[model samples]
Target: MPEGLIVKALSGYYYVQNSEGGQPVQCRGRGIFKNRGESPLVGDRVLFSETENGEGTVEEILPRFSELIRPQIANADLAVLVFSVVRPELNLLLLDKFLVHTEHARMNALLVFTKMDRIPDDEEGESIRRVVEDARALYSSIGYEVILTSAHEGEGMDKLRQALAGHINMLAGQSGVGKSSLVNALVPGLTLATNEISTKLGRGKHTTRHVELIPLAGGGYMADTPGFSQLDFAELGIDEIGSCFREFRERASTCKFRGCTHTHEPHCAVLQAKEQGEISESRYSHYVGFMTEWKETKRRY
Candidate 1:
């Protein structure tokens, strides 16, 4: 069977990039996938056949090692969490929430802080600067790769490119945080739409409409999808959420009890670390918030 990767899907068409590397085949998925309630996604490895007509048809979707739900891609090697340090401003709580999902999914996360040139030098920018510095220290300490970049000024572009080299990277972040701009910078001549931030609304309109995996010059591929502001944790469980927080998971073994919720428990290693300033209170607070929300969800069930 001829094998290829579904690089882009649009309007019931799958553009499969074959290993032989000619033009991407505009293929339709086999009808059986619909009956099986499975759809071929960008980044999916597929077995396809050429029809009597010119186009091809996807016959089977091979098994995926990992799948991301938000933008919905299969076999993504890296999750590039892009965020702006200015404009819409940095949201640590949201970043931590994103980290939880990435951790749970077992996807290697690369934190790309964008728009560094937008950071102001005045007194008003003090807090923002502090937040960026702190976040770099905090997340880097937790074993994540952090790259600060300004796509406009070309700052850290080489570092960012080096980090993304030879891997299937999927970009995720809020709109206007420079996901498209970064992609444009990284991949020359490939212009991804980027909108100016609405000064009134403090957010950018969605510029990316669909998911399409673009092959990079550096022996890898990248998918830029619609940026989003919020995520649903409905797929996660209360107990499983603990292990998703890297710091909490690290201290889980030393807790007074197995499966410690880390909320008001005596001799809790996590709580103790939080009090001692080992764990960032900001991160711990969000973890507790997730726990509270999930608890309410469990009650309703």
Candidate 2:
């Protein structure tokens, strides 16, 4: 019996790193897990029993600060949302969903726009850069950081490295968006599997089927997560939605009502921002869509 941390869990095996570990000790939980409704997840600190033969058994799971249902990781510091500017194209809707989920999980959201090399022409590249800058501003206004990247060309690699320097980052995005490629670029020699975008669908094939945390060269962990077509917003309530969109908070406070949904609410500052060309229409639309769906789901539940 010894103390350790669960670094990775897959199939039915858990990799536990002991307090005096030379290497991570692989262990399986006792059958008690099934009865107690407990499943060990990554980032979980646990007590384990070590056999003389170098095997181990998970004895108990420690408390967690937060848990993400999709990737099923615990105590994540940040969520890196990766997307390409062209190929599959950027889905602002999905981006918002990831940001909301990150906030709900109590983790910071970092936007990483990949594949900048594809943006042709000095003029065209500048245009694309402007779009990214605008997006950066939009998220930054709401207290999130956004960075541009090209896993192939190595653009912004330094900044990306610095940004991910100390945090436990979970890399999340749709399939074929180069999440794995970015990981390989960040920590050379860690060639995680990567797939090309489908020509027929103009999208990426979902390659990463599970989540695994890779230690960076400097000093941090980057989680390579599975890709998905959609996220379940029903898990979040209407009240929890507004705070995720940080830009809205400042103006939302000025709304006439105490608890403004910002949809059909009289004298809403968010609407005014859209009218005044202050907030990007795309983000406002995302907020409205999410707010509407959350309210509907709440009613149904």
Which candidate gets the maximum TM-score versus the true structure?
1
**Considering every candidate listed, which one attains the maximal lDDT?**
1
Candidate 2 Cα deviation (angstroms), residue 238: 1.6
RMSD of every prediction: 1.4, 2.2
Alpha-carbon runs more than 4 Å astray in model 2? 19-21, 122-127, 295-301
TM-score of every prediction relative to native: 0.96, 0.91
For model 1, residues 1-301, the per-residue Cα lDDT tens digits are: 7899999999999999988889899999989999999999999999999878769999999999999888889999899999899888888888988888888888989999999999888987887888889999999998899999999999999998888888899899988888999999999999888899999999999999999998888888988988887876777897789999888898989999877889988999999999999998888999999888777877777
Residue 27 of model 2, lDDT score: 91
Model 2 per-residue lDDT tens digits across residues 14-58: 998776757888898989988989888887778998878887899
Model 1: per-residue Cα lDDT at residue 100: 87
Instruction: State the lDDT at 135 in candidate 2.
Output: 73
Give candidate 1 misplaced runs (Cα > 4 Å).
299-301
